[model samples]
Target: MDTDVISAAIDFGLQKLSFTEIKINQRKVVESFLAGKDVFFCSPTGSGKSLTFEIAPFVFKYLQKNDMCIVLVISPLTSLMRTQTQALNRKGIKAPNKSSLGDVKEGKIDIIFSSPESLIGHERKLLLDLAKKNFIKTVFVDEAHCIKKFGLPDKKKKKLAYRPCYGRLDEIRSLVGGHVPVVALTATATEETKAVIKKQLCMDNCSEIMVNPDKKNVTYWVHNLPSDDICTNFRWLVNLLRGYKQATSRMIIFFRQIKHMADVYEYLETSLKHDAYIDFKEGGPNDNRNRLFDMFHMKTDDDVKDFICTSYMNPNGNIRVVLCSTSFSMGLDVKGVDTVIHYGPANDVDDYVQESGRAGREPSQQCNAILLTYKRCLGSQNIFPSMKEYVKSKTCRRAFILNIFKTIVEHAHIPHFCCDICRLSCKCACSCEDECVCTNTCNQVLPKINTAIMSNEDNDDSDDNDDNDITELDDMFSSDSDSDVLESSTRKPQVIYSSDDEMF
Candidate 1:
């Protein structure tokens, strides 16, 4: 199992920390990184995905017996880039910003951190110069999902004048120039997003490591609240705070809109008035755009932690809660987060999964995820209408969530390929005779399925409403009915052949 290699990697990382911390999953990722292969890691937030790449260079340096630049971690969020650079510094490793390429050329750093845009200018010249001197090796794209839209739309532009420059990623590739291996990392990437990364990075053959998206250690429960009062929600939050007061835990509460964030913050401040123990950091959506930039350029671990707890007090303590929107969900890793309370229903399953994934990162069995929802007019419709898919799916909760990606991978056969893992693992496969293991499992469980059907039928017949519902039930059971045929199929068939001339 390469336990010594794993231990050495841990020892290397632990030198920077005062406390003892060992992450097995992080070690596995390090092993993959050391093999000089491109990886697409699907670990949840707070599961130490960043540390996986951070510790890889150290291992590579020891084994390869050289001090060359083995990693170039490109992050979309400035905050994340800064956080990573600072973390490297804490470990006595110099990971400077790409903007300081001139300084780096004089042997001032071992790693380079920058945004996709920052690497395109004079920075590419410096990197190429260093490459001639044999100094660069591996490239890591932190939030690789953004590479999909590498040069599409300026964030400053509000109108629809967005034109995509497809060659932007290609330009970066030309700069790197095939000398160093590239590892792209992300917490949430659809199949389309991954294809964009592969194409942009110019990786001919890439290996993927998919960490199960389900955080089973975190128990999930939803609350149906009656009122839309921010103050009322504050009281409920206060109760949660009191419960976790003494426990060493962190929390992130998600809001749907900027105005909702402001409302919640104001209500908490006023209602919890002068609660010296409580601290909050306000991350307004507009400000978050720049905050990400600042985070990428940060120079220390303390700065990274500070940004995480920006809106909360005692960030390093056992309990800290940051009230944020969707911006906080992607590529942010923190440990011992006991709860992630969504103040409102998420817009889609993807958003919900990513947000809920923040809890129970350390493999504990007692973590909790509380979702608070209410009936509110999001425009003319419910903002969370799509949640019905999750609630109504006949498949297991985990299977249903994973199938969302499977559907995408199936539909988007770009670069002339489909998801092989989905085909092998999904329950939708036909039979074991077709070389499917899930099909065998399904067949073995068919008796239970039959029992369930009988039980449902018995219950339906025993119901008091059965007699009154009989006429409607008869209409439903009439398979030959025109209404039934129309409702069952939404598509009109087209005739593809004519046989009148052949008959003559």
Candidate 2:
């Protein structure tokens, strides 16, 4: 990194972005962008992925280049596009109105943040017009993994066909030019997914800068809930929250199903009675989801502690706690989160890596990631092989994730606050210390997987009246059926697959 670039980044972080210093990864990404290369950069959440793309306009401004030379960011969701728009506007940068196709063609906009759906539909003509004038210097695909899942529509599913823009991202290269730079940014991408992204995006000779996915500051663990009862799960969560209430206070609880989220919310809100600070959030069939989203991510001085929402709930505040779903994974940029608790094991280790990556984003703060799992969900879903191996293996958890990246690390390379296996082997620094070895006096504690039995309420056998008694939530899925809780085997598949591209 050049001294001028480094100094400029630091000044921008402190004065403009309100950060004390610029991150190394941020510097490298900016350098790459300045070099005019198409980049496939995989960095952990909160490591400044947004800044990598956002800084381009500022650099161009500094160079006294054509102000019309702008960056086009293609995000996966409307919520993310809105979030980016708000953040950039805060820095006094001009953000294109997402609804106005005319603003895209005007060439006065410094940057246009949009979704693939918007690009392929509303803004297609204007965006191509700008591309023809050589107005867009770079095109960024944020959360590029969605290009695989949401790209093509599964026409068999009517809802998915509504916005089949996800699969047509490769068409973005055509909208712009073949020679224009495309930067694909994602926090999590398996080796298989990477190959797919490269081919789909037409990045035959794209250079990649992948920082190690492991966050040494974040400690990982799996907690086996002894019972299948939702109440039992509730009790365990209360205890864990109470324990981490002090220094490592901020947290997010992730869920795999909407009904499970609703069920847990009922128990906590109705039974436990912590409704003010804690709330339930989910993507809706309408703007209701978006409204709850702004309340959480758009911080006001009045905001309080403990928001219980879906993974779609963005952590904007110095949120001490969150309860959400898989939608929370990828490209979330909140900092100083002390913990991330998954209500159950993720669908796969890749999902696990992305969700767990949210914690301990600030290098100065060591955070904890706890995965709570029940035996039944595992049996019903046939948990991913890596996830199954992750829970049962007597090896280093961090090393397991690293191996996913095809890197080999010996036991000797394990960090101080190592995983359960490393700690049990007496390889952790706290092994000899009666008090916890953590600088914060927190021990590498791995509670025995609970042996509690399922309550009758959680038992599978039930009368027909159970379906009639269910309450409707705001989401698209009907919670009354087991089809809602189980993985894809039982539910209506969200997207129909025409090729292997849709599988992941």
lDDT of 1: 0.51
Instruction: Estimate, for each residue in 361-424, the C-alpha lDDT of model 2 and write its tens digit.
Output: 7787866777776645544232466776777666788888888877554435344366655655
lDDT (tens digit, per residue) of candidate 1 on 1-504: 366865775576555443366566665566665666666676666666777656656656656666664566665545545555656677677777546545578645667776555566546677677667766666777756555433344344342211132336566656766646677777665566667677777877767876656555554544444445666645655544444443424667776544455566555555543341433244523332122111111122333434554423233543356666454565655555666777655655656777787766677444656566543412212233445455433434444566666632222211101111222233532455765545243222222212221232222222221112322111211011112222222123221111111000
Best by lDDT: 2
Shift in Å, residue 154, candidate 1: 13
Give the residue spans of candidate 2 off by over 4 A: 1-27, 62-64, 98-103, 152-164, 239-248, 274-319, 380-383, 409-416, 427-504
Scored by lDDT, model 2 comes in at 0.59
**Considering summed lDDT, which 10 consecutive residues are worst modelled in model 2?**
297-306
Task: Give the C-alpha miss distance for residue 202 in model 2, angstroms.
Answer: 0.4
lDDT to native, each model: 0.51, 0.59
Instruction: Please give the RMSD to the true structure for each candidate, in Å.
Output: 17.6, 9.2
